[model samples]
Target: MNFIKTPTLLKNKSLSLLITARVSSNFAYQMLTVAIGWQMYSLTHSAFYLGLIGLVQFLPMLVLSLFVGHISDRYDRRKIVSISQLVQGICIALLAFGNYNGWITKESFLIMVFFIALAHSFEGPPMQALLPNIVERKIFPKASALVSSASQFAVIVGPGFAGILYSFGASLIYSITAGLLILASVLIIQIHVNKEERKPDPVNLKSFFAGITFIKSRPIILGAISLDLFAVLFGGATALLPIYASSILKIGSFGLGVLRSAPAVGALLMSALLTRKPLKRNVGKIMFTAVVCFGLSTIIFAISKSVIVSFLALFVLGASDVISVVIRSTLVQLETPDNMRGRVSSVNMIFIGTSNQLGEFESGITASLLGTVPAALLGGVGTILVVLIWRKLFSSLFTVDSFEGSKN
Candidate 1:
């Protein structure tokens, strides 16, 4: 997974390779989740199972967070990532085979989902850590935005495409997902990092918690990371999209795909703009404001019965989220030393995974008890409250004005 350094053009090629690798894998999973959500909800007719799916995915990330950082920093991160994709592909192939044979049940499906999450738990941090290695520091913010663009673009297409393909059967969806994941593995193998020496310290208990310690010590980094963690923790309504598609908007699987892809559409557009012109001023204020916008969009989405209005709200939501993501990612990578980036990234991943997967569980339970619309509205309002509180708590983050800050 590690290769010799080459020219600047090769660096760009490596960057492209990284983005393609990311896009392929991300696209595959986006499709996988779309199909899985539809299948699970169809079989059970329960939103709780959807939350269970989130819980299954989340337990692994929470359990594995301690060790993943040490492994990423100490081993070949690219190999780790490629191997993770390989495992996921194999699991998807098993899913396809099982579905074809007519033995896949909800219980069995969740078991498979756990393994997929297990593989993904190893994948996330290493993948995040890989970006800084590809491009020079000066160009990293632009490259980071480009990497986000690839992810967003994948999200934009994969679900909508999955909805179209889903008419054939779950087996077809699973088969295609497996193939794309394998392609991602292949692409990851081709990426060559710059000659950044990976100086891994010997593994110990201390190393496991180092990432957390590192984050807690840096206020700007801490502020950025925690802001995303809590904001999205309350704001995310991803786990409930299936319910919305089927019951609320009455939009079937294709409409579900459209609703799912809507945010990514906005995110892709925003990321493209950022790639062209990275944020130059008021970085902290911009991120906080973006979170507030995200909350407002969620509220709009929760209340809207009209398909067009919901999609538009989601579009605005995606655009707002990318702003927070790009700023937080840039700050985390730019400030951390290379040796600690993986550990730091692992901690960051835990927060991200928690905010998303755990948030899914939160949405699911809330939806089950309070009804979907109320649950979603609560999330939107909670997100805004979190932002207001975080601003007071993390005052250091609000005054910061640029990406060119003190590097640790």
Candidate 2:
């Protein structure tokens, strides 16, 4: 197949800077995730505690998403993202200090996780909403692909880097994370945002809940977002990776890093490919098919004992997920108005974010009760079931032919 020529999106300086910031921040966050999971497991050796880490991080989004969305719409989104990155950097620094002095306990680590989550909760809506402002509507898919690819590349590197650094010490891993976050904040600060277009309405109970109301009115958007929500909620196998690395696969931290990086490696490659040749026809069908493949890949990963086979499954999982992500992101960005983007993106975050973190919690609880292998096997099955149910409930989504003409 002939690769499409590069689009003009890359020529936009603000978009380039935004992608840089995303890559930097995501790299730090990915490393932090690996470090924390390893440390949490080492400290407690309990799946429940590992699950609680996700819950603690997600709680802030659950409680504050509405307010955060409102703020993103009303305030300077660039500033919101920069400030949140700074706060997160400080939190990482504190964690690093605690780790360095041998003073870090599970409680302290969890506390830091809460603050990190709180900062990110404030950052999520605005950061997502800012992209449309930076790129033209015609190039949204390419822009989204480039941005997602950058983050995926970070995901691939971050865990492997963290795993290597872990042999040195947890403090080293966290300290580096803090530095990367600070750098990300600096990069974000350099982007120039046009303020003339921003017209935020006064904050009120009605305005706060506007995002939820908007999503409800749009069946296609609602269906697309909810499909991901339930599928990932049941299908995600990431939370149990630590257990697999330790007990099932018998791989050490190095192997864990490789496993964590495998999906992103696939995702990054797929994302790069999408940028070259954007999806056009049968978008909805493609998304549904990719998700089913994701479930099947998860099942393969769950049952595999060989490291190579597990990596291949995760690679497929990541590749399938990128197809869904590019479609969903393009749909959400194109369907919503600029003023409402922040709010809509916030609602989107709640669904996708909750699915990720809550999925981790569910995996932990199930692993505790059903054993790790069975828990993951069941999650894969649940993902397939969700796809079937969603196909029936959101039949409109299945018929969507193009991202540009998607109806709200």
Candidate 3:
């Protein structure tokens, strides 16, 4: 909370508005995820369907990443984001209507999320590209920290908020999320930034592929990006949390909410610490170390039968993940030029999108085959293996000592 009040950051009205808008939308998105996961699980009682939700969301992300990036670069980034949020809010409201009337079949539920994903794909890239322009270079790190903390705050409470509302009804959760998202849209539309209108690249094959080419040319960026993709692809234990809450932990929806939020609690705390004492050295090493810690924490969570132990492991995993996230994100932003930011962010989004949505599919398939516990265990072991392989292959990324280190 205190982090939001940092004097340098709040001086910019646009930054302030953007952060607040992001907080509202992110909170809605998090709560929406909880609602979707739980509602689908409750109705179908199938891990496969739960995973299907991720696939549905991923399709738009995969198909539209390039176009979204190009559009972000060409258009008013703030406008792109505002419209995206509005679209999602409208779809969520529809979801609420369908849900309240008991008309949302599993198939319908899947379709709704697909539309939400379409809006989401549009939202992520431009929103990311806009931040750098809204504030000074020197204050970007602090700004980024505050943004991350806002997201972490949403993470910490969003699911829990959903859970409490869910006790009233699933429709209540969707309805509230819809209202929040619409509020976010309205708030953000009023923001103003200092970016100059540049003549964007032409619409051609080369323009479409620019982001890919830039990332491929930088080993550090390539390694950092790829490492996150594969690691999360293998280690997306969160996808199976509903099953854990219902089958293993014998918990109700409220308890599931707590488990869902445990990692974010750790993430929020660690983000605050890093904000106060920004990383000054061993930057790359710390990122790798954090990844390793994340993997180990997953393992601990996988093995733990007790609720408290599982919660603690998830907390540590979330904490460790933020360290890697802050480093990788800073590296990506600082290294790339402003004009290229939108495209590069999109490329990053694709990897992140794949790792998350596809990872859910993988988790579901594996859980079905291996059982929930074994699926989780295998993911933890697999994450460690990725770190081991990535550390050797991406040695340049591993050894770098600063956020602005050479891309070579």
- The TM-score values for the models, in the order shown, are 0.96, 0.97, 0.97
TM-score of 3: 0.97
Worst 10 residues of 3 by lDDT: 399-408
Against the true structure, candidate 1 reaches a TM-score of 0.96
- Candidate 2 has an lDDT of 0.89
Whole-model lDDT values for every prediction: 0.88, 0.89, 0.86
Ranking of models by lDDT: 2, 1, 3
- C-alpha positional error of residue 329 in candidate 1 after TM-score superposition, expressed in Å: 0.7
Identify the superior model by lDDT, candidate 1 or candidate 3. Answer: 1
Give the distance in Å from residue 345's predicted Cα in candidate 1 to where it truly belongs: 0.7
Which stretches of model 1 miss by more than 4 angstroms?
A: 1-11, 406-408
Summarize candidate 2's per-residue lDDT along 68-149 as a digit string, tens digits: 8888888788888899999999988999899999998899888989899998898888899888888778888988988998
For candidate 1, the lDDT comes to 0.88
- In model 2, state the lDDT of residue 374: 92
Alpha carbon lDDT of residue 150, candidate 1?
73
